[model samples]
Target: MPEALERTVYVVGPRWHHHAAHADYAVAASLACQLSAQVKKLNSPIEYRWLSRALVRRLLTQSKGEPNYSLGTLLTEIVVARHMWRRGGSLYHLLYGERDRTLARSLPRLFTRPVIATFHSPPARLAHKGIDRRRLRGLEAVLVVAASQRRYFEEQGVTRVFVTMHGVDTQFFHPAPAPAAGPPRCIVVGGHLRDFETLGHTIRLIRERVRGLRTVILGAPTRWQQSLYSAGGGSVEFRYGISDHQLLAAYQASSLALLPYQDATASNALLESMACGLPVVTSDVGGVPEYTGSDGAILCPPRDPEVMAQAAVRVLDDPAYARERRVRGRTRSLQFDFSVAARQLLDVYATVLGDAGMASG
Candidate 1:
């Protein structure tokens, strides 16, 4: 029997920077780091290497204003691909596919190694940002956070498309020891694709119906603070740059997770909230229903403050219903643990490597 060639997979993506001390957050921003960590524990033949952060920063700075399809971006990708070629890797995975679409499609021609990419944006977001189908056809595989996004890639003629559900750190975000005794409070976290206008309106309506209803908005941009505060009818509290312990504490103390989104794929806020045993009421847009399903959350139409507010009030008024939602949400979150996602990703890596080897033979 011949000795098998060793396999190396290089992970390329933006640095997982968080203000909190803990690496775990509800958003998929930490996917590269979390996924890499899980892959390491499996003790498989595949070895993973991260592209140097200094190199990434240099490339990002060069392509600051125009990150996609620009002359600078093209040069950046070429530089990165050539660097990897010289460094030597059996395969390459681009964690943020949007940043390196051109590289992903062209790598196979320039080098014999297989390339795969994971895309986080929904179809509408992708369309708005602009993606070239021709540039993406070269990928060995495409991984998406939501099932709804699979069709876009398949339509573009990419043969292998997989839906890898976003994962959360369940142990860190676990529920409180017991419900806190105080006025009902709701938490809103993260600002990406969030409908702040509708959130302000919904909070106002929620306060009118439920007395002593406190709302906390975390990670909101400083520019929008005044408007949100005024719209929240002076019952809103804003916090920023807090550590992970504080964040987990906030989730545990809150009564419900009230999130309104213009569009979404997979939300860290929703998953983190559910894992913390906080009931969720969020918008029913792209991939939101797919993650929450019928029982996991109370879904409301986008930009409809009245409907959102009504749902919030209902959860606040009925203890039994709120408890039911909390139980269902935590149960649902177990399905998205980081370990599960790591196993699925490992399988994809093995299959891609096997196919690549057969092609060469």
Candidate 2:
């Protein structure tokens, strides 16, 4: 394939907003939009075409292994694969990694060019299970956002792996003027793997120590889920299906960000909150520490309410210390800027395409 002709890169994944309740889809959407903008501004010889929900039909048969899987998804993969196999392309990028066993193996055989899988992750359980490994079999490269994921994939004998940190939109999530003097407020964002039981416990403990501290839970909790927090001592507010503007506003107004997750991989809320210069108290699990850095935020063991509560109080009680953490966090966020990641990703694209002439550039 000519370098010029192979400039278009096809991306396959769930629609970024396909699931309004899931934060991962939002991250997928943000990445697609940002990466496209960055590549265009650089006048790079590449373009990304995304395919997700529209590609697959919602078939009920896949409910057992893939409850979310659809007939459209399966057909689309074959469609894209057959197209690349018959015609020609530089590479096929699977953003959600792999969908199913048969598709993962067949897609590669159907493509003459390299197949690059990115933006994929499963809970530690799913990835380790014998079934999902089928998805990793035929790929030219795998891009991960978390260190733990990279390690996990490598341990499985997969090579040519890369780690890309999640990027933050500083312009959107930047710090704002502190809210009117009142009780300090904290926020819990994102629905994936969040441990609300731990959150309730931590909030109760925090309210006992910190006077007038309030919390806002955005994303994931239905009215029944909201009822689980009956023991709240501090004020607790819940909001669902809010706009990004409203979410960012919550981040800016809050003094601390709480992300007590039960399981693996990345957290979009962690990056957005830290970018907004809010202190974070998150579970010390998976790739979270990769973003939070050693000193940027407070890390506590998962399901431990007492330790998490103490960490929150420490940040809220010490204004000077909290401010320092905020400053450090914002500085760390800049390193993961989309532009830098875009350039690096372009290099990966060039390398995987075997464009020796352009890869060196």
Candidate 3:
């Protein structure tokens, strides 16, 4: 390690430029904060630093409309690499690689150490080709959020694979007393890549069967809102950007959380819902089961709206079952603490650094 003042690790992730605000990609931002804090508390040789997302955005503003538009990410990587090149004693950590898919390939040479990265979704390329290989290269390990992703990475022979489940701030998401007068309700959250088309069908199912149920859909984009406008005859509330406090209220007021994702590799909303003592009913695809475990949340067949709706209704209608689920949900959330994720992540850094040391020696 370099002198104490120079020892550091660099983290690159989504650009949440606001004053530490919680945006759609805030899950990674929060986890980054946790990791940084833990590293500081340990008083190790390395310090944690984040690449300036704002700097990247400002420098590449004209390229915002570029096709696939990864110029900002590319510039960020180059900037960070140059910075680390000058600093000479930092490890590169890609917090999802942001949009720079080729980050790993370039980072290792600059840092003189293997780069570590996490993936939120599968590789975009259907088949690995020229640039795809570099895009997937240079990582010491690729940490995934669930076993399903690990399986995919192993099958494809990617770098080292590890399961790192999503973490939640239990203290921030703890349960509130259920509103005494509100009708039985369920919450729908997540955005962009979610299965809103299927969620529309699920809402219809809920309307047909469950009486006096309120369905609050949070963070539904214009496309989703337009498609789901007539859904449930307006019983379904399509809420566009909501605050964290509002989201917590939605969770605490609900009987269950519904996520009809076409596919997933662990969900931030699922973890948050359970952390707030809300049971969940989501599609059983990808890493849904990994997050739900055996009993915390009910899992239904994907694309089957009726089954998903029925599961939510069952959790809501049966007081005894909901109570059991609440207990299980909170218990499950406890197991996914940030500390657990931090331990595993720090271990990966240690291993990578040790391997680099051995090779150098």
Candidate 4:
């Protein structure tokens, strides 16, 4: 067991957009390419399955009301367990908290390898399920993306943990050679608006606070989201379900971006928006403050429509300040670039391998 030899680190999770060129899937694929490690994205196929009905039903029954458990959820757990047992390597799962430790426990008992659980968000559901704090001991190290999530993991008694913030790909998200300069252009992105009042508030601001400003909302609509849009008086242009390139283009075209989530962990949209040379007006929730640093973006207390509106106008009206923020944000966004992220991830794998006495080069 040497420290210099490279060892396999598998990222097991529910299926991301492996078939399509989506950002989340692209992030996973890009990370794998950068690390030069084995990458298998397992998505639970809802329409078809090779598993027996009895097994599927039993799994569904056991995973009821639990986060990360659907037909896809069941398939992911089973497939990941089989993959780990069939061929040996260090197990690294990218998920929020230990909400689904049952999947982690499925690793082969005699393999004698460590499971590194990367916590992406606060365990909102684990607390709801009343899962005991002691169960997290199954993981060897908890890699956290935010301080808030780190505190939650510490409360869960997962002492062997480290904080490694999420990174973005600057090269892909770089600002266009030139940004459009004209009337105020605002871009609002992400989903599930009803769950978060930010959308309604943002629309209200567009209607009242900043009149004559062009606003565009991106992503497909959920039923609840439609209700939120209706509540906003239906004046804003809503572009439902667009490609990743379209979203990036919208960010580049707009004067400012709005990421007003109710309870955010780390928003991919916000990061991508900043990387595209637009200053983000986001809620000071989850890992946002960590990503924006001090100079790049505007942070407001969540759930306040007036404050959100005022902040949006401030960025849109002040050209000098807005340009400065965009430059600073774009610069900071480089830290999360895939190349940098892959190298840091490899370091984590090396640390885990060294601890486990596996060969690493």
Candidate 5:
């Protein structure tokens, strides 16, 4: 295929796990895995592939120990570019996350192959400074995780757009059988404890509004998680470093899932929770509304503790409404089932390669 044994593609991103990073990296890795299978389906060779590093020592030097943009992520992109150039391959696809529009823009011109970028969210403040509208035009396709992001990219002139929803391993997040029980258990998974100040503040509010609620905060503890439990007036419990399956059980056991983010779009926590047949209470930020929809979740304003608290209370008070939302959420999650989304992504890759092959011929 394409006069080469192995076709190469690269993932551009920050660290692969923890907080929001987990979903983006997981999606990219899954895409790569799926692509490997499809390429074999086409009887192509298993060739070179690279993933950018997760740590940046250089950026730390410039910012005096804090990188404005992730140095590890930038280096990773650069490494991938170097690999493509060295391999002399004419086909490359870029799956981007947590970086600048301008930097991503330069990649297609530099790499001499078809580039496709999946926009994880809007550009950060630094990257926003010299953002180039031209960046969106060169890619074979600009993937938006949520329909809500489509307009923003359109404004930037990225017309060849596709809405590929985020995916979760159904095997990992399958719904549990109906429990013969009393008050439905509820929990919030993947709280961004790295940004604990905001996370803790929101949990405190949830504690106030919903009394005697068994809330489990999953992820490594930052000072904020500990402080939230200590100062939370004996309501919320903190559990650190639980395996993914255990996390899934938490979702299966819970009646509702809460995603309290200061600002985020298409969070994995929301999808995983919904996949486990749990309705959600999440902030109305980014592409979240697109995924959660009207039937699946209760939306609240960002960073407003009072509003978030009330949203959680609403779910606790109405069993019928909660059950309806959970049913809808589970149905919605199937639309993003990995098998479905992976095939779509494989189709995109096939399209890009076919076009490249035509131009070369």
Candidate 6:
């Protein structure tokens, strides 16, 4: 194949929302834009074309829905795969694996070109969602956010699985010039796969130990979460749908980030908090250690509120310890910068295409 042809790739995923007015941290989660920017920076021959949202909407209106899958998403995958089968490319990369199983199952009949996907869900969640080998039959590579996820895909016979780092915009989420003046504040962001019972208990415990403690919960929580975490609340504030600047301000203002997770692959909230120079007290489960390592953040066993509370209180009480963690976390976050992730992903593309020299220049 010609080098130009080999460098051409198509990316299919969720509709991207660009926040040009705000910092990168304010932008919603999606790699399509970041990947494009990095490829340009490398000055590589790679050409990426993302499917338009308008096309996706049109397809959704014309297609029937599938059980347990979004009608628009299912139709988009089928249509995109069919289009790629007719029109040749070096590879087809699905940005989200959960949305691509139908495409994977149908790819073998449509074409023989290599197809790769990135899977974000943890093993347990994937298994619960019925993501078996059959649904993932035609994928040439499965890129996961954590090494821990490799076993589940490998056990299901995915021979070419790779761990890809989840990237963060370090420039936008940098530490504050000076700590905010007020009572000690602990910020809890996001509600996905979070152990709210543990969080609630930990908050109660921390409040008793630390004087003038304030807890801020970010993101839109469910009724269950709101009711559970808000009960017997003392200085707990819940903020929903705030702008990116406000979100960044919350992280900068907080003394520490308290993230109690039931399970995780990679957490945006964890990464962003660390990038903002806030020390973390997170659960030691599924890829959390991989991101934080030994010294970057304090880790507690899952569902253990006492340990979680103790870690948070320690950060709040000890200035020297908090500074050490703050510096270490900021340094750790640089390794997972968007540029690094982009380079790694391009290497994955090269491997799948069997072009050893690709992206080397």
Indicate whether candidate 5 or candidate 6 has the larger lDDT: 6
Q: How many clashes does the backbone of model 1 have?
A: 1
Estimate the Cα RMSD of every predicted model relative to the unseen true structure: 5.9, 5.8, 5.9, 3.9, 6.2, 5.8
Q: lDDT tens digits, residues 325-354, model 1? A: 999999988887766665566666667767
The C-alpha lDDT values of all candidates are 0.75, 0.66, 0.66, 0.64, 0.61, 0.74
Counting only residues 3 or more apart in sequence or on different chains, how many pairs clash (N, Cα, C under 3 Å) in candidate 4?
11
TM-scores for all candidates: the values are 0.82, 0.81, 0.80, 0.83, 0.72, 0.84
Candidate 4 lDDT by residue in tens digits, 104-193: 544534355567666564557446545446556567677776677766777777776776666665766779777666767777776732
Which residue pairs collide in model 6, if any?
A: none
Stretches of candidate 5 off by over 4 Å are 1-15, 19-79, 86-90, 99-107, 123-141, 155-159, 180-185, 191-211, 220-223, 303-307, 353-361
Off by over 4 Å in 4: 1-5, 14-22, 25-33, 37-50, 65-68, 92-100, 108-112, 123-126, 129-135, 192-198, 220-234, 359-361
lDDT of 1 at 247: 94
**What's the TM for model 5?**
0.72
Ten-residue stretch with the least lDDT total in model 1: 39-48
Score residue 20 of candidate 1 by CA lDDT: 35
The superposed Cα distance between candidate 6 and the true structure at residue 307, in angstroms, equals 0.8
Candidate 2 stretches greater than 4 Å from native: 1-7, 18-67, 98-103, 128-131, 223-228, 355-361
Instruction: State the displacement of the C-alpha of residue 325, model 4, in Å, after optimal TM-score superposition.
Output: 1.9
Candidate 1: lDDT over CA atoms? 0.75
- Which wins on lDDT, candidate 1 or candidate 3? 1
On TM-score, the stronger of 4 and 5 is 4
